[model samples]
Target: MTIRIFRPLRVRDFRLLWSGMTISALGDGIYTVALAWQVYDLSNTPTALSVVGVAWFLPQVASVLLAGVIADRVDRRLLMIFADVLRAIAIGVLGVLSVAGELRLWHVWVLVALYGIGNSFFYPAYTALVPQVVSKELLVEAAALRQFVRPLTMRVAGPALGGAIVAGLGAGAAFLIDAASFGASIAALLLMTARPVIRAEGKTMGSVLGDMRDGVRYVLSQRWLSMTLLAVTFAMIFFLGPVFVLMPFVVKNHLQGGAGGLGLVFAAGGVGALVSSLVMAQRGLPRRPLVVVYVAWALAAFALVGYAEADDLWEAVLVSALSVGALVAGQIVWEALLQRCVPSEYLGRVASVDSFVSSGLVPLSLAITGPIAGALGALVTLRWAGVIAGAILLGFLVVLSAATALQPRPDPGRA
Candidate 1:
């Protein structure tokens, strides 16, 4: 079982891509802690804290569709490398200013905007690039391997390492470490000898806008794809942003903890996710992926209800593990299904459109979360958000069940 899960690593291109992604994802975890602390340090308000996320998510909303078009027209390897370079330079400059004590709240927003643009461009290219390097037989394992390494590095090791660095050295050092990690990914991209095959033969358009519209129509035409996107979009709109904006406060004010404590909580979630990913990797995804995705997500949303009520840091840690573990399990299934089902010609555009729709409201959600937290208090708001999100997810399951029940059944006598 272990051998099967690790089989993707034997492919040279996938191994390189995976290795680079692992390093980069770890850096991302480190950056998450560093960025949160840096923003909070500058202005200790929920509203102020939201600016960084708003900056990050706004570009994702604005340019993701265009990024998809660009990914299809260009070399995906070069596109990813460009994104890494842009993000690295942005963070590198921020790290320099931060360490020198000249950094301010506004600088964080501005620089992270550039980082966000780079981020918005990277994913579509990365998603489309994967299948070009790996065989159909190994694609599922490749996805599983990625899920495994992501939690192992990003969630578990990254946050723990970031928290220690921030505690011992400071957030500036953590920022620099994150900036440096991009170099490993860039090097891997540079070393790849093969030019990936692009499948956009008849899919090209006279204009980028035409391309974007085509992508949207394609997604809309597929009921399974569109339905899955709709479910994730609404659920994330209610859950993701509030959690990101509020969790720090819950750790700080409610639990009386610091960056290290928050990191520990994040790491706990990673540990649980690691276990969940391992099980999926070993056994492979369940036969019914759509069912698994919604069920797992519903359980995750409900787990947050317990999170808001945690009495101490340890209790929070345990709940974090469960909620985040369930989230990872669903994500692994959904992503693997996406790669397997989508035509390669549409993969880049579809990936972008998928991200755009799923995340479209996230910025607004982040923008509102602060004001909501300020009015209702972070824990109260989080608790209510969990209930709403959980109920909505279960509603999706109910609808699916009813539809299945209404389907016509076959009989041997009729045949």
Candidate 2:
């Protein structure tokens, strides 16, 4: 089992892509720390922090469908490279502005919007590209490996290092590091020889919309897929804002912690996620993958309630670790299921719609989280949000459990 966990690494293309993505994930962790702290430091308001989330999500909401279409029509590796180049340039400029002490809230917002746009294009292509590089028998192992590396680098090492850098040097240094990481990712993409599963087929402007509509119809036709997406959308709407917008404030105001403390909290969560990923990589999926996914997600939501009630930094760290561990475990299974079930021809579009729907309400949540926290208090807001999300997820678990569509169908290779 242990040896099998590393099986995906033997594939040259997956290995190179994974290496680049791991480096990129580390930069993302650093960028997240810098962005959150820089916003709070400049404006000293929860609303200001919320604005950053809103700015990033808005462009994603608008551009994701087009991104999905483009991914399906062209070489996904090239699309990812283009996105990385754009992101690298934007972050580089942001680092320069920050170092010059000429940075403003609006400046951050604009650059983040650009970053979000790039992400919108990159993610769908990346998700669809994974199976192309690895054989079907190795899909679960491949996803598990990625889940492991992502948190280990992005969450554990990245945030911890970013925190130290922000404390010792400045956020600008972290941003500069993030910019350089994108170059590594682009190089990896250039080295990949994977071909697109779906080609343009002489695509026209009208056919593009038709393709998107077909994608939507495909999702709707699957009861399990639609229901799972519906549940996730609501859960994200209720959960994401409080966690992202209020956590930094919880560290600074409630716990009297610094950037280093916040970094420690994130790193702890990464450690937990890393452990979960390793376990999943070894154990593989359960008999009922969907059931395990929903139950694990529900546990994660309940853990957030613990986070909201924590009195000190260590308490938050412990709770966050538990939550992240469960979340990552569930996600690994979920990704494997999607890769196995969804047809390769429409995988890019399906994955994009999945992302779009799950994140569709995030901007609204961010917009409201600040005002709600300001009025109700951060702890109260976070606690209640967790409760609501957990309840919703439990309901989803019940529904999915009873649905034959989501039940395990025998896969000779996997089982």
Candidate 3:
């Protein structure tokens, strides 16, 4: 059982892709630590930190639908490589400016916006590309392995290393490392040789807007996919803002901790996610993947309520771990289901819509959370966010349970 989890590594192309993505994830973890700390340091306000979130997500919301169309119509590998190159340039500039002591909050906002643009293109392509690189039998394993390694590196080791470097040196070093990591990912993409999935005969590629509309129509037509996306969108709107915007304040003001403490809290979440990923990798998908997905997410939301009321660093660490573990477990199953069920021609577009819907409201959430927290108090804001998210998930679970269309259909060919 244990050895089977690592079976995906035997595929040479997947091995290279996985290794490169792992390095990139690690760098991203470090980059996140640096970016958040830098923002708070510059303005000493939660609103400023919220601005960072807004800058990153607003661009993504604007372009992600189009990005999905491009992903479906072009070589996903090339799209990913181009996105990486753009991110490398953005991060590299940020690094140079930081080291020269010419960095400003506006500068961070601009660079982060650029990074978000890169992300808009990178994610859909990457999601759609994964299934192409590995055999169908390895789909679940590949997805599990990715979920396991990404959080382990990006969330666990990456944030910890970034925090240390920031404390001992500065944010500049972390930015440089992130830039280099993008270069590594680009190189890996260049080496990969995978043929693009052919479009169905007699199917004409539409304009980007037309393609996006078709994608939206397709998701709405599927009861399970639409409902699942709705649940995720609402959950993220209520959950992500509080965690990203208030966690730093909670660490500094409530716990009286510094960068290292913040990193540890984030790392704790990674630990939990890694553990969950390991379990999923070994066990494979649950017998009832859809039911498990909703239930796990609901549990995760309830666990997040613990974060709102936590009084000490240890309490925060424990709750963060629990929340992330539950979240990641469901996410792994969700990815696998999408890869298994969605048609190859429409996979990129579906993945894009998934990203788009899930993240569409995030910018608004991030933009308002700071003011809401300032008015209502951070603890009150975070607590209510969790409660709302939990309620939404519970509702989703009940509704989905009654939908016969969402029930699992057996695949005799599946391993």
Q: Estimate each model's TM-score.
A: 0.83, 0.84, 0.87
Which has the greatest TM-score? 3
- In model 3, which residue pairs have backbone atoms overlapping below 3 Å? none
Which runs of model 2 end up more than 4 angstroms from their true locations?
33-53, 96-107, 163-174, 199-206, 245-264, 308-316, 369-384, 408-415
Q: Can you give the lDDT of residue 368 in candidate 3?
A: 83
| lDDT ranking, high to low | 3, 2, 1
Q: Give candidate 3's error at residue 257 in angstroms.
A: 7.3
Determine the backbone clash count of candidate 2. 0
Each model's Cα RMSD: 5.3, 3.8, 3.3
**Selected candidate, larger TM-score, 1 vs 2:** 2
lDDT tens string, model 3, 1-415?
Answer: 2555688899777887887788888899899999988888788998898778889878978888888889889888889988999999999999999988899999998999999999999988888887787766677788878888887777668888999989988999889989999999988888889557668789998888898888888778778888989889888888878878887788778887788888788888888877887788787767788888888888888775787788889998898888889998888888888877776677789898888877787677787899999999988888888899889988987887777766645333323
Q: What lDDT does the true structure give each of the candidates?
A: 0.80, 0.83, 0.84
* lDDT of candidate 1 over 1-415, digit per residue (tens): 2567788789898889989988999999899888888888888888887667788778767888888888877778999999999999989988898899999988988899999899889999888887778765566677777877887776667888999999998899999999999999999999886565455547434588887787788788666677667777787877876678788778888898789899888788878877777777776756777788888898898776776899999998998888888988888777776676676657788899888876787777777888888998887888888888888877877776666621212111110
TM-score between candidate 2 and the true structure: 0.84
